[model samples]
Target chain A: MPKIVAFACEHSAYEAATAALERKTGTAVSGENPRFPIVEVEILKVPCTGRVEVIDILKALEGGAGIVVLLGCFEEACHYLTGNVRAKKRVGYVRRIIQDIGLEENRVQFFSLAPDMDARFSGIIEELSKQVVNMGPGPVTRIRDQTTKEQAQAAQAR
Target chain B: MIVAEQKPVAEILRMIEGYRKILVVGCGTCVTVCMAGGEKEAGILASLIRMAWAREGRLGPLIDVSETTVERQCEWEFLQEISEKVAASDAVLSMGCGAGVQAMARMFEGKVILPALNTKFIGMPERQGLWTELCAGCGDCVLDRTGGICPIARCSKSLLNGPCGGSQNGKCEVSKDIDCAWQLIFDRMKSLGRLEALGAMLPPKDWSKNRDGGPRKVVREDMLL
Candidate 1:
């Protein structure tokens, strides 16, 4: 199972992402089934991507997600004038931070799309999913396994 | 406002390696304006250090990082307010300018004082998002002529007489991106019709006033210890 998380803003990006999922598969567009492969892809709808704190992104990675992608409204098209720009800057900051902490920088990415651009939106998901497949599970999962093994050995010694 | 940049996360983490209880102090005046040693920055640094320590699998000592913001660290009174918190902590991380850090060190003589940011220079805010260093604190001001471009402030060599022939097309020969300060002065003076002032030639700057013998000190008779 590919564990992916999509952080979408309340504006155009969320709507466009939903529409793209419906368009990708021939499923009926409904609230129940948004229709994207890996239905477990947790979709976090934020008020604005700019409001998504860097700590939130780090905590999500710590919680075990192979890939985390932030989707924002197109440049200059955001409901807030420079909200998307701020989001981009924060994402850039987070990318550097993740790399410094020993995580692959490519695991985190940002995509911009207008409310009606379904093709571009779908392409982004497909590309991100392919990258996740190549990278495999995140480091948190491996660290957990190692800790579990160490605990078991210590328990046996006792 | 005094500008400073946060020390790298790894370096900060290494500095506080053994300390379990830490106190993070921030100066709200100069450092706050620079977005370096402010309340927000201090909180972020403390959080990052905490996380890094947790990853080391040591279940580290009782780590207590608290924040206290002071108006100006140059005064001993503002620093004295945090005497209780300073006494309780195993180590103190100061996120103020160099002056503030030194003041903290002086106030708490035997306590370990670590600087969390590097002090850069005296500069003015260029715009909302930009700050450019404008003064080297050479203990002199010669902005009367040459339209406010201090040959001492902006020039690489701090030349006051004239361009050193290393300036080409208004750019310094040492580095391409830098605009020769003398060239800028020349243009500004020409525009103001004050080019005649350039012929006067400034004498060598007096060095006594700036870091001459040792660390600079100022005394006020009315505000004595």
Candidate 2:
């Protein structure tokens, strides 16, 4: 099973995640709150999905999350009119960064939700979790170990 | 402005093949404003090339891909600033406009100067989010009659007489959505009471002054080197 770290903002996505857990829904939806599977996933609640930075997402990848998902409010529904759009742009920047660093772009994903869509949130999480399971461990974690070794050799050479 | 667009990544990669030591030079002027051959884009391209090289299990030559310490106007002193970095590398990839690339080629005679972007056209910002090429450098500008609109500049056919028979209701035949530049000029001139000026027969444009021969040269005694 892939270790999934999901960032749910303080707004609708968190509420939906909680609702999904209460409803025992195996899927991730947008607005409705549903139940979540307890064993394979860890959820981190943030102030706002827009608050999450590219560096933070990269740190999560380095920390062994096979897949990291950013859950935020819908595009035009953010409390801040363009916050979601900004978040999308940052996500795209980080995606390019990861790809440049030789990691698959699919390791990072973004989803939007409203306060009431628990079932949809749960469904999305379930589907993404399964996808992550099939994709296996992320490339960054594997590459870091080798990079560290190379750095050690370079240090010794000096 | 020196406008340019990024070359395809695959094409850039292929051009740098077999070169171990590579120097990526970025321009900080027009290419930067256009988001093509600027510092950030140069860094991205360098990183991507490094990653691609790593995939082949061959650590590249002492590749030092860095930006040129210059603006995008092709001045010689600015090109001189990157002389040390350029000398250290085996090949150079310039992320600049065509003028900048040509300047680098001229300054560093015999050195391989590869262009990382395709030079486009001179254009101005349409509004905040768009840019439209309005000038064609026809060697003659007639902004007097059309209220600053150059029919030669914006018209698809460069029609100086009247809108071709293809014009419909004031839009160009080439594109229905675009207002005919000639029509816009005529309307503006007519409103300005300059319509009678348009009735005067203008002679045929001198094509020899444009590009009939080889490259054109302009000499200014006041700015002589």
Q: Compared with the true structure, what per-residue lDDT tens digits does model 2 show for residues B1-225?
A: 555688877788789887878888888888887777777777667755654554444442354344453565388888888888888887889988888888999999878989989988777767743666776676766777668887876888888887888888998888887888888988899889888888888889877767777677778999997
Off by over 4 Å in 2: A1-72, A86-108, A113-158, B58-69
Task: State the lDDT of candidate 1 residue by residue for A55-108, as single tens digits.
Answer: 576666656677777889888887878888888887888788666545678777
TM-scores for chain B, in order? 0.90, 0.89
Q: In terms of docking quality, how is candidate 2 classified?
A: incorrect
lDDT of 1 by residue, B11-30 (tens): 77778878878898988888
On a 0 to 100 scale, what is the lDDT of residue B183 in model 2? 87
Q: Residue A70 deviation, candidate 2, in Å?
A: 5.4
List chain A TM-scores, every candidate, in order.
0.79, 0.78
Residue B176 displacement (Å), model 1: 2.0
